[model samples]
Target: MHRLEQQFIDNQWVRSRGARYLPVMNPYREEVLAEVTAGAPQDVDDAVKTAQRALPAWRSLGGAKRATYLEGFAAALTRRREALVRLSSTNNGKVLAEAAIDLDDAIACYRYYADQARRLDERQGAAVSVEMANVEARCYHDPVGVVGLITPWNFPLVTSAWKLAPALAAGCTAVLKPSEVTPLPEQALAEIALEIGLPSGVLNLLNGDGEGIGAPLSRHAGIDKISFTGSNRVGEAVMAAAAERTVGVSLELGGKSPILVMEDADPEQAADWVMAGIYFNAGQICSATSRLLVHEAVADSLYSALEKRIDALVLGNPLAEQTDMGPLANARQRETVNGYLATAEQEGLRVVRDARHRQLPSRGYFVAPTLYRDVPLTSRLWKEEIFGPVLCGHSVANEQEAIALANDSDFGLAATVISGDGDRARRIGRELRAGSIWFNSEQLVLPETGWGGFKRSGIGRELGPWGLSSYLEVKHVIGPSHG
Candidate 1:
């Protein structure tokens, strides 16, 4: 078994001060995959202080130079792509194909932010027009300073990249606390940072549970900013911590996103998109479109197609090439999801499909892809973020009803609109109250697009220019027109 007992601090892999060690498991085999260090509150202090110390030099290094370092990170990721992909799959219980997609997205994020970093140089101190003739103004984007980056277990390296790339590109040093449940894949990031000669303490990686590292890091006074991607419960805690210090905070939280399929759409094609929406990454995606709102005229055909597709999914070892779906990240996740399933049974929800209909692996934390039709509007399964391959759906009378159902959610992270007519799909998509909307397509997220939603879904956006901006503070400078 792999033993990762050291935390990356000040560019060195040092044994953690905390005596606790958490076992990292391979969900598919129900075996211990690795033992990672659980960092102590002291470790958080050391990491945050180190990052605070390194901030000045790193920030003053200039955006063009930061872009070069970001490019180096991209290059290092490229060289270690295959190994990282396998590690991510093994640690996170996602299929190899999905793990590869995560790595690719990570690599692309670094490269994309590298370009943005270069542009920052040109944008710095750019002239701003003013109505008053005598006064000239310029705007400057400055680094927000030392930041604490906490990522969830589901996406592993992908979420790390989403936060880290932009934070670094914006010239901020960071202390990253990846989830203790699946920390193996994230270890590569620290290795790459050191290999690429990132300034000592510019990037500190601590492996631990929320209590051990995340809590301390979020509350650390040295941290000038906090960016977190996880559940709403933790996001609120982080926000409260940031409030104490009045520091900048960016949170990407939970979702019970919707997928609206119009009657005009082809059932077969819509089924594929629906499967990809809720089944990809075993529906661990925060932006998973788990609440399906189908047009009443086509509900029967769409449900039939979805049942067939769900049954066809290969549930086994994530490392296998043919495995379309893998076990949940860990036993706790499985238990949490199973609790929801049990509740659904108690509520007497119309279970269209579930694990009862499939023969799962002999040993694994697997949850068969589930579908519930005609679910009550008030059911927990219909409103809560299950974070599993559980799709709760019902029929809507028409496009208006579909749009109304889609918008009726506490979480507005994302939505999918499917229709034969592109114009109709786009028009309907425009009405959904989600941050990311897809029209006649699978759930495609790129580094160029912004992420994070309205209301309780999240506090700030990530990816694209918005991500880089999160780690930056803007300043306005005014002077005489001819100065």
Candidate 2:
């Protein structure tokens, strides 16, 4: 039984004032891995104040100095790569390969931001050419200051890295609230900071649920920005709370992204990509392609191939090297997925695969990958974001029908077009109302590209230069030229 019951505040591991403790469970084993302090509003205040105090000095260090710290953080992560992979797999119930990939992505993200930070002031800045004579105007990019980073449990370290690395790169101090389910990795990052002798109060971490810490952090006046990645409902609450102080907020919310398979696409290839998209990370990804719009000519063949590929998936311990899929992150998530399964059954959708046909470990929260076809357009199975390893497929007669069906949803986070014809794929990709679109392939997010959505999916991007901009405040400095 691991007991890690403390919050990292002002560069110190301090015991919480609150008495409650939240258990961090190994989702695959359904056992308590560790217990973390359930921080209260006072703890949130402490973290925010610490971050606020540290901001001025951190920003004054400028981009070059900040880059060195970020590079140090990246090196620290590299040294702890193996431990981080094991922790992520055990705590989050992701396959070992996925966990390793998550760490690698985080390391790359930090390094990318380190490079960006080194060149932030040099490569990018605004020096306007004014129309009026003897008038010289320039703009400066300044840190947003004391940002409150709230990341979800799905991809704990990677998501937090997206916010933290960029915030640090932009020369901002932050108070991070990792999900109560998986706060270990974020805490581990703080531990590395401590080991590297990072300045006090530059990066603080508070661990708690939404009610205990999230609300207070969002509404805190000392927090100049709130960068959040979670459910849309909570994101709305964060936005509303931040409105109280007019604080800057960047949210990467929920998604019900879809993929379109053209008639020209190979059924086998389409099946493989679609399976990977929906089942990777157990379909917990916000940009997951959960909805598939297939051309009628190839729908039957593609669906059959997908069923065969999905059946070949191995589900077991995340630590096991051969396990292709692991359990849901927690029992609650299993229940939620089961609820959706029941709804799909009631709606009379064609269930291609589910847990009823498979044997799973009785001890943990496990849900078999499911594929539903001929789903009603109005059913929740088609509209709601299940956020589990479930796919809802629809058949479209032509390209026009496919595009229309794909764009019918309230979400526009991501869409993919699979076609043999590159020209046709490019044309269709342009018509999809999503932030990210792929042609003939689907994989993980690239750090250099922007990642966000339209409509209810999300408000702002979270990676690349766009992500760095989210943590910065731009100001126009106008003065008379004494030439």
C-alpha lDDT values of all predictions: 0.91, 0.88
What TM-score fits each model?
A: 0.98, 0.98
Candidate 2 per-residue lDDT over residues 253-303, each given as its tens digit: 888988899999999999988987899999888888999999999999999
Clashes (N, CA, C under 3 Å) per candidate: 0, 0
Q: In terms of TM-score, how similar is model 2 to the real structure?
A: 0.98
Query: To one decimal, what is the Cα RMSD in angstroms of model 2 from the true structure?
Result: 1.2
Lowest-lDDT window of 10 residues in candidate 2? 118-127
Which residue window of length 10 is worst by lDDT in model 1? 351-360
- The Cα error of candidate 2 at residue 127, in Å, is 2.2
